[model samples]
Target chain A: MTDPDTDRHNAKMAKKKAARDKIMATKTDEKGLVIVHTGKGKGKSSSAFGMIFRCIAHDMPCAVVQFIKGGMGTGERDLIIKNFSDLCDFHTMGEGFTWETQDKSRDIEMAQAAWAKAKELIADPVNRMVLLDEINIAIRYDYVDVAEVVTFLRDHKPPMTHVVLTGRNAREELIELADLVTEMELVKHPFRSGVKAQAGVEF
Target chain B: MTDPDTDRHNAKMAKKKAARDKIMATKTDEKGLVIVHTGKGKGKSSSAFGMIFRCIAHDMPCAVVQFIKGGMGTGERDLIIKNFSDLCDFHTMGEGFTWETQDKSRDIEMAQAAWAKAKELIADPVNRMVLLDEINIAIRYDYVDVAEVVTFLRDHKPPMTHVVLTGRNAREELIELADLVTEMELVKHPFRSGVKAQAGVEF
Candidate 1:
C-alpha cells in the first residue's frame, strides 16, 4: 500500500498545481513593461542594472542613461562598458547629487539634457531595454517635470521596449503608470553601523 | 575668470567631499558580510546572482545553494552552470517548492543535504561569496532549523566570505545578526495584473 503521508502530500500538491496551471493558462499576452524601482534603500539602481545584464545575456540591445550619479566610476559600469560595449549603450549624464552640486538651475539643466538623451534612446526601436538611473530622484527634486515625463513614457515609448526608472521617492503618478514597481526598503544598513561601501558589493 | 556657476558647483562639491572623506577615513576595517533580502516582492535571488556575477567579473570565486526551486530549468541556473562553471559552484538541492513536493520528511532530508553542501563551501576559504538562494523558504517551512543555521553562520563562515540569504519571511534573529538587510516591498506586480512570468525578465 502507498504511504498515507505521501498520498496526502501528493493530493495537496495536485490541487495547488491545478490552480497555478489555470492562472498560467490565462496569461498569454506579451508586451514591454514600464518598470519602477524606488524607496529609501539601496539596490534600486543595482536591480535595474541586473535586468540590463539579463537582457544582454539574452543578446538584447540595452541602454542606460544615468542621472544624479556621475562623480565616480563603478565596477558594474566599467565592466559592462568594457566587455559588452557593442550590446550596451552606457551614459553618465549627471554632474553629481544635488547636495554636492548645490545649484538648482544647473541641476535642472543637466536633468533636461539627460531627459533629451533618454527620449532619443526611447525612440530607438533597436533598443530592447532602456534604464533611466536615478530619474526618480531628479523628478523628486523638481529637476525634471514629472507630468511631461509621464506623458512621454505613456505615449512615446516604443511598444516592445522595456523601460526601468530607479531611485528613491518615485512619483505616485509614475508608480501608477508602471507595469511593475518594487520598493527597496532599508531594513538594516552597514553604513549606519560605520561600515563603508565596498567595490564589488556596493559600487 | 571661471564661470560663476562652475565655481559655485566646485566649492559645494569640495565641502561635501570633505565630509565624505572624514567618514571614509573611519571605515578602515574590512570583513565579510551577512546580507539578507526578504519581503513580498521579487528580485531577492536575482540580486544575489547579480553579486555572484560581479564577483565572477572580478575573478572572485562564488557559490550558490538553491533550496526550494527545483522543478524546472531557469535561464540563470542553466547559463551560470554552463558558462561560469569554473568560478561558480552551483547547486540546486531541493526537489522543488514544499507545496509542489508535498513531502515533509523528503523536504527535510533534501534541506539537510543542501546544508551539508553549504557547510562544505563555507569551510572553503577560497570562496569570496556564498549565496543561499531560497534558504529562508526552507527554514520557514521547518525543513531547517534557524538557530543552528545562525550559529554556524556566526561562528563558522570565513572572515571575508560574503553570505547572502534570499527569500520571504526571514527570521528575526537572522535579521538581527545580518550586516545588511533589504526588504523588497511589493508596490505593483505584473503577475497580479495577469502577466505570466517571462524568460529573461522573470527567470
Candidate 2:
C-alpha cells in the first residue's frame, strides 16, 4: 500500500516543479549588470569581494578600486592581490574615511582620482568585473559628482563588464539605474553590545 | 612655500586622526559571534562564504552545513572541498528545497540530520567557524525546531567558534539570540526583469 503522505508530497512537488519551470522558461536574457550594494548594514563590500572571488575561480580578470577606505589593510585585499596578482588590479585610492581625513577638498581629490581609476578599469574589455568599493559613500559626501558618475555609468561602461558599487547611503539615481540592488538593513549589531570587530571577520 | 591645499589637508587630517584614535582606544573586547543573514534579498549565502574564505585565508578551520539546497553543485562547494579540503568541512545534507522535495517528513528528517552534523561541528573546538547555510528556511518551514537550535547556539557553541546562519524569514527568536543580524532587503532583482540566474553570479 502506498503511503498517503508520500503520495500527497509527490503531487505537490509536481505542481511546484511545473510552476518553477514555467518561470524559468520566461527568463532568457543575458547581459552585464550594474549592481549596487547599499544601506546601513554590513556585507556590501564583503558581497562584492565574494563576486570577485567567484570571478577569480572562473579565471576571469577583475579590478577593485577602493574609495574612502584606505587607512587599514584588509585580508580580502591582501589575499586577492597575493594569490591572483596577474588577474586582479587592486587600488586603494582614498587616504582614509572622511571622519579620519576631515579635509573636504582633499577627499574630493582622492575620490576623483579613484573615479579616474574606476573609469579606466571599466573601459577595459579585458576586465570582466570592476568593483567600485565604497564609491557610494564618496558620492554621498559629494566627494564625486553623482550626476557625472551616473552619466558615465550609463554611457561609458563597457558592454560586457559588470560593475559593483558598494557602500552605505547610495543615491536615488544610482539605484534607478542599477540592474540589481540590495540594501542591507541592520537588525542587530554586536558593536552596539560592545563587541569589538575582529580581524578576519570585520576586515 | 608650502602649497596651501597640501598644508590645509595635512592639518585637517591630523585633527581627524586624533579623533579616530580616541574612538579606536575604547574597542577592546573579542568573542565569537552568532551572525544571522536573513530577509528578502540576495547575498545571504554569498556573504557567509566570504567569511569562510576569510577564515581559510587566515588558516582557521571552517565548516559548512547546507540545508534545503542540495540538488545542484555550487562553485564554492566544489572549489573549497577541492582546494582547502583540510580546512573546510562541507556537507550538503538536504535533498533539495521544500518545493522540490514536497515531502514534509523527509525534509524534517534531512534537517534533523543536518542539525546533528552541525552540532558535531560546533562541539569540536577545531572548527573556528561554522556556516549553517539556508537553515533558516528549514526552521521557517517547521522542518527543524527553532527553540532547540537557539538553545544549542546559546549554550553549547564553543567560546571562540563563530556561527553564521543564512536564509530568508529567520525566526524572531533566532534574531534575538544572534550577536549580529543583517537583513538583506531587495531593492531590485534581475529575475523581475526576466533575466535568468547566471552561473558565476547566482550559484
Give me the candidate number with maximum DockQ: 2
- Best model number under lDDT: 2
lDDT of 1 by residue, A16-102 (tens): 878877888988767789999888866677667777777777788999999967522265677688778898999989988876776
Question: Considering only N, C-alpha and C atoms within 3 Å, which residue pairs clash in candidate 2?
Answer: none
TM-score of 2: 0.91
Q: Candidate 2 at B72: error in angstroms?
A: 9.7
Candidate 1 chain A weakest ten by summed lDDT: A70-79
| Model 1 regions lying over 4 Å from their true place | A1-6, A70-73, A101-106, B1-21, B70-73, B103-105
Off by over 4 Å in 2: A70-73, B1-23, B70-73
lDDT of 2 by residue, B1-203 (tens): 55787677668768878976776677678888999999898778877788888888888889999986743227577767767879889998998887777677788899999999999999998999999999998899777899999999999999888999999999999998999999999999999889887655676
Q: What is the TM-score of each candidate against the true structure?
A: 0.89, 0.91
Say which docking band candidate 1 falls in.
acceptable
Q: Candidate 2 residues A18-92, lDDT tens each?
A: 999899899998777899999888788887888787777777889999995652227678777777788789998
Distance from true location, Cα of A66 in model 1, Å: 1.8
